[model samples]
Every structure is written in C-alpha cells, then in structure tokens.
Target: MRDRKIYILLTDTGTVLTRMIRLYTKKNYNHASLSLDSNLEEVYSFGRKRPRNPFIGGFVKEDITNGLLHNAECVIYSCTISQKQYEEIQAFLNEIESHEHSYRYNLLGLFAFMLKKEIRRKNAYFCSEFVATALTKGEIVQLRKPPSFVAPHDFEEVGDFQLEYRGKLASFYHNKNHSYQLSLSS
Candidate 1:
C-alpha cells in the first residue's frame, strides 16, 4: 500500500441516458469510473465526451465538476494493491490514455448484457467494462464474468473494496477538508 492505490467511482450520472438505464436496470447507479488516486483527478471511464449527448463515447478522463458528472450522485470505493500491481495498472492506463483514439464505447456489449448475453469487442468498452478490466488487470479483483457483462451495481457486491465516500461528486471533489477518509455513510 506504500506505492499504489485504486478506487472505483460509481455514479448515477443524472443524465438522460443514465436515467433511462436506471429505469431499465432498476439499479442505484449506471456509470462507473476507475481512479488511481482518491481525489479522482485522474478518473477514467468510457462515456459521453459531451454530457448532453448520450452518443459519442470513448476512453475519457472523467472529472466530478465536468460535463455529465457535475453534482452527480456517486459512491466511491478504495482498494489497496502492491507496488508491482500499481506499476502494471499505470502502464496500462498510460497506454490507453496515450492512444485513447483507438478505443470506442461498446454499445453492442451493453445491449448484449441487457439481453443476458455476452459480446466482446476489441478496443471497445462501456463504463463498467473499462473499470472492471482495469481492476482485473491490476489483480485487484478476479471478475468471474466478462468485463462487458459486468454492471456498475456489481462492484457493490464485493466485500473487499472499502466504501470511502458516498454523496454528490461535488461534495467529495470540492471538500474543504481535502481528505479521502470521509464517513462511510452519506
């Protein structure tokens, strides 16, 4: 834990598309983001580049105050991993972020999940798939299902990750305290 940290940021997003997804899945959240830090300054996910439009998604560096995530309701979980794992995750993220143009949102995978099917597309991922892949690659979690089949709500089922924060993204992002050790309950 000296050299690395990993976090899962699950957001309801409060966008029309996410709201529509919530209605369909009857779940608490519809979007997922992964971060190597607690402040979430480096959050990454596959989602709309522009919040207003549900379309046009790819590898994105996410922020709480930006476009879709502004004031979004979210739950954040923190996990500790070894230095070796951290380096591996960092390398993967570096590659992905540097070549972000090579990736796209997996709309077909999302549809397949809704239909209780599995579809894997190279260089394509949805929000949860991306995060799940990162966590899996980091050896933080052994995902029994394909990353594409993983949903935002699924992360909550695991007991290992610590629920560090829950509430509006703005609350944690803009907290005057500037600490990640907030209360477990909002």
Candidate 2:
C-alpha cells in the first residue's frame, strides 16, 4: 500500500495578536495548522473564526487564499504515514468538524503553557496543541510531552517530517503551480 502524506504549516501572519505572541516566544512563526493535502486544500487549525474578530475562535478549516494567511510567511513540512494512520486522521477531523460548535480555542491553555503547566480542556485546543493531538491520535507521532505543551517549533524537532517549502503562504500555491506548468511544457 502507498503511504500518505500530511502537512504541518507553521506561519507568521504578523497580526497584532501574532506580534504579541512574538514578544513572548520570540519565534519566527507563531501559528500552526495541519493540512491533509500537499496543496493545502484541507487545512485545519484553532484560530479566529472571523478574520476581523480575534475573539471568537474554534476549530477552523483555514482558507489560505485570504484572511491572515494571505500574505503570511510560512514553512511547510510533510510527514509520511500509513494509509491506516491517514484514515484515522480523517475520521478524527471529521468528528471534530461535525461538532465544530462544541469546540473552542484554548485561550486558558495557551496561558497555562506559558506558565509551564498542562491544561487539557475537554474540547478546546490551541493551534499547535490541536495539531499535536491529531497526529498522536492518528498513531503517526509520539509526543515526549503533553500535547498542551507542544509548540509549532517543537514539531520540527520531534517528527520525522521533511521540509517541503519555505516562503509566503500564497506563493506556495503559485510556485507549486508554476513548477507543474514548467514540467508539463517540458
């Protein structure tokens, strides 16, 4: 059977909230998302439900073509997983999406992480925490620490992920399409 790939997207959107997070973490990317496809057509994250309002947040199916990710800087990493693991991930995400209203962004958990504490809220999660939990639930990666403690940078350090791309989030699609066109013409 062929192995399937999942993507980890680390982004720095340079929003006011992201700027505040940068002050604390001093990291290049302050947000993370998981994508089921290399084209990033199926991306998920715990972030603002509305681009203009950062207050209302939950599990979101991200649209990279607009909003915060439109011009964001990002790094994409791909991890190979068995078909069984891929199916597990799909089922997990589907379950969450089906009851999306029950989930909320873990604001308190984020603060707990800053305080070096683990707060696993029943159905809430911050971006990286959610991504880590998803991968763990899929049986693809084992976490040395609690999912609540996982950060965007930590995925790079822990997983056997391959660096897929680095540059603007918008440009990823542009470049991918450009490269495909180049190959097609050759």
Local error of candidate 2 at residue 119 (angstroms): 1.2
Q: Provide the lDDT at 10 for model 1.
A: 90
lDDT of each: 0.84, 0.88
Badly placed stretches (over 4 Å) of model 2 are 179-186
Local accuracy of candidate 1 as per-residue lDDT tens digits, 1-186: 475668888998777788889988899888998888767778888998776667888988886776668688989888778998898888888988888899999988898999989888989899999888888888878988888889999998877788988888877767824664545766
lDDT tens digits, residues 55-170, model 2?
Answer: 89999999988878979998888898999999999999999999999999999999999999888899999999999999999998989898999988887786488787887878
Task: Look at candidate 1 and give me any clashing residue pairs.
Answer: none
RMSD of candidates 1 onward, in order: 1.7, 3.2
Query: Which TM-score value belongs to model 2?
Result: 0.94
Instruction: Kindly provide the TM-score of model 1 when superposed on the true structure, using C-alpha atoms.
Output: 0.93
| Candidate 2 global CA lDDT score | 0.88
Residue-level lDDT for 37 in candidate 1? 74
Clashes of each: 0, 0
